[model samples]
Target: MEALDSPKLDEHSQALVAMNEVFQRQRKDYLANPYPDYTSRIRDLRKLAQLVQDHKDALARAISEDYGNRSVDETLFAEILPVLEGIQETIKHLRKWMRPERRRVRQLVYPLASNRLIAQPLGVVGVIVPWNFPINLAFSPLTSIFAAGNRALVKMSDRSPRLAAFLKRVVTDYFPREKLAFIDDGHQLGPEFSALPFDHLLFTGSTQTGKAVMASAATNLTPVTLELGGKSPAVVAPDFPLEVAAERILFWKLMNAGQICTNIDYLFLPESKVREFVELTQKIAHQRYPDLQAPDYTSIIDDRSYQRLWDTVADAQQKGTQVVNVFPGNEGDGALRKFPLHLLIEPNDDSLVMQREIFGPLLPIKTYRDPQEVIEYINSRERPLAFYPFTRNKSLRDLYLQRVMSGGACVNNCLLHVAQHDLPFGGVGHSGIGHYHGKEGFINFSKLRPVHYQGFIDGLKPLMPPYGEKSRKILEFMIRRARS
Candidate 1:
């Protein structure tokens, strides 16, 4: 019994030892050369871009194999292209981001004293990558990490074994193990990964797992940026064309089989437009994906996720909700784990479909009579990662924008806000915390150290220790000046 347990314990211990070794090497490397110059940082970014460019085909294939049949185009568009473009944008702006900001000194010491805020790297960062959009999530954060002159150790999801193995094999050629490393979750090293003493951690996954990761990181007092998912909604205004709304919503909803965190989990349509909206969405789905088993259609990640989606639809149906198969007569191949897109009409709040994030291709839509009803119902729940309100009216758009708070939002579109390199992406409340992307990403991975340069003459000399008539007069003058 002891011998049998010893091997299991040894396996776990070996995983821990490997992770710790890489972490220590990175920490030591960062301390030795705390700040990497502009040229070196640019070199790192170039290497990253080149690596993806060289392996674009293999990377897409690995991701496709991991998903059982992830569309090659989807992988390229959603994952590869965005990351490549993001790296390019970061390279363009990194020099400006690295410069020390000269802050205005107070009037009292204006002449000689100077204030400067420098964005300095914060040692090594730990990244926990989710299986969905693995390359984008991992490399996007890495772009920020490297731009801020820090090293990183990324943990790959267990579900993406093929991609993880492929990345691990090729990453060393681009970056030294001491500068960057990828840890596979094959040994169930997620908990161990988060528990390490990293300067910062960026996790992109479910909200439930985010809580555990945050708790584990708290032990080391490490800062975290959690990009968790929630029930993000898209509301179509009465003025907006149902045909256009259906096309945009369904495109994002069915992309990657709706595995996106910022995907439209639920939708709100005007009470009068429900039937017409459903019809338009059905037509659009049929047109976009005629064959559910085709490589163009992505499979649900694994057996558990595939079954969860089926169970969700069953639960909704049992609760007396209308479930529509977007592509009728195509139930998808169960063995291949392909799942057809579903629309749950008017699912109750208590039902599983409405209660959870609905990470797959299931879209639960509710009918709304007024904007207030839509606003009230959504605001009553946890703040979502994204909110989409399609309207041409400026007043209505502004109202929705001001009233509905989310991690991010797109006015007339969905998921396009995230595609923009200049905008910061993050969540609020239950959705997520801390913004990262663009300048925010650079700042989030860096420490803004404030420095003060002393003047040739001490301004406080007159106010020093001894309380006398002259000191009192000076204090009075200073107080009056401050008030003025």
Candidate 2:
């Protein structure tokens, strides 16, 4: 097979010109076939699934190369599996989701009238995928976009160069430019990409970048779904065992080296159990990753990220925050870029680690005297992408579920909620906007157009513009009935 040419980054204007050409082609194709049949949609989804399956090993290797040493298991589990599962789920329910929903007609328009909602496909969707979990972030949303029977144009993050290049080549080989295309521009073309007049735009990245995408999208008044990340918190109820909390939290935190958007950014532990929780987390870390330099433990994505994590920890320590390296002895060689998990205990509010989303193996543990304090503390900050509460107590779990506002929540678990094909995954407030998973995802890329059918007999003739005494009498009767 001939190698696909990578996008040139000589000039931003030239890149935009190329990007717009692709977008227009997709738009034209969409116009040709606005609503695809169930069979056609299923074919598209299945083709995508098979493409992923065929390239699974290659994609994993490219991702690992991009991250220096990302574990194959992590890529398979966090990125590949979710996408494959999501594709199957979409295939299973596409027919039902495509069915028009019957709605009730008002009494006034009752005679030979009916209402229904048609899930019409938006013309074209633009998806901006982030670096971390690149495959899942790109393909997961693409599954929904395809399920909704729309064309798509994806922009991969420049940070994951190898994966981006690999996907650009593979996607082109598998899909037509008008049906599905990938843009792997290693330049400052983000502004231009987001500025396109797409039917719908979905972006997954930092809160600051999300804001810029939203701003650019405003020019076209394009509807957007911003999956932004923030300081997602995990609260360990006193009733829950420290061991369980530590184990579950470490699983997510250590995954992708804690680069996940939904990973617990900080922990709210019961004040008395703080020390014990730390020890338990350390023990769990040791058991899971006995050697820090092992391939199972993912390395930091790049030099910039490695330095950022180090700077965060150093700043916290300087501000009188207690720093505990979970694996103290085995500081992997600098070449490997594998940094052990660092626990920041009670980092000051002004500390960098506490203020920013530490997208690394640095975990900040905050203590709360009362569960209510935990609630108040979490609420005081911006709502996060996810909230995890490890509690077996029904009342406490319900309390957290009701009180704490997050994009999504998991009870007694971490990060599994996003994997559920039936549930919608999205963030709230600063975390994200809109949802995309299962039926909700299908709806996200579709315009739920309400259609009404009426018989030849005009039911509203009595209430026409040229109202008379008869119309007044009918209005009076309706008012009396409403009042009664």
Predicted structure with the largest lDDT when compared to the true one: 1
Give lDDT per model, in order.
Answer: 0.92, 0.90
Model 2 C-alpha lDDT per residue in residues 1-484, reported as the tens digit of each score? 0112344444565667678889999999999999999999999999999999999999999999988899999999988899999999899989999999999876574577889999999989999999899999999999999999999999998888888888777787678999999888686678999999999999999999999999999999999999998998998888888887787888889999999999999988877998888888878898999887889989988888888888888899999999998888765457878989989999899999878898999989898888889899899999999999989999999999999999999999888899999999999999999999899999999999999988667878888978899999998988988899
Q: How accurate is candidate 1 locally (lDDT)?
A: 0.92
Cα deviation of 168 in candidate 2 (Å)?
Answer: 1.8
Model 2 lDDT, residue 246, Cα: 84
Per-residue lDDT of model 1, residues 341-386, tens digit only: 8888899999998898888899898998899999999999999999
Worst 10 residues of 2 by lDDT: 1-10
Give candidates' CA RMSD values in order.
Answer: 2.4, 2.7
Task: Name the runs in model 2 displaced over 4 angstroms.
Answer: 1-11
Please state the error at residue 215 of candidate 2 in Å: 0.4
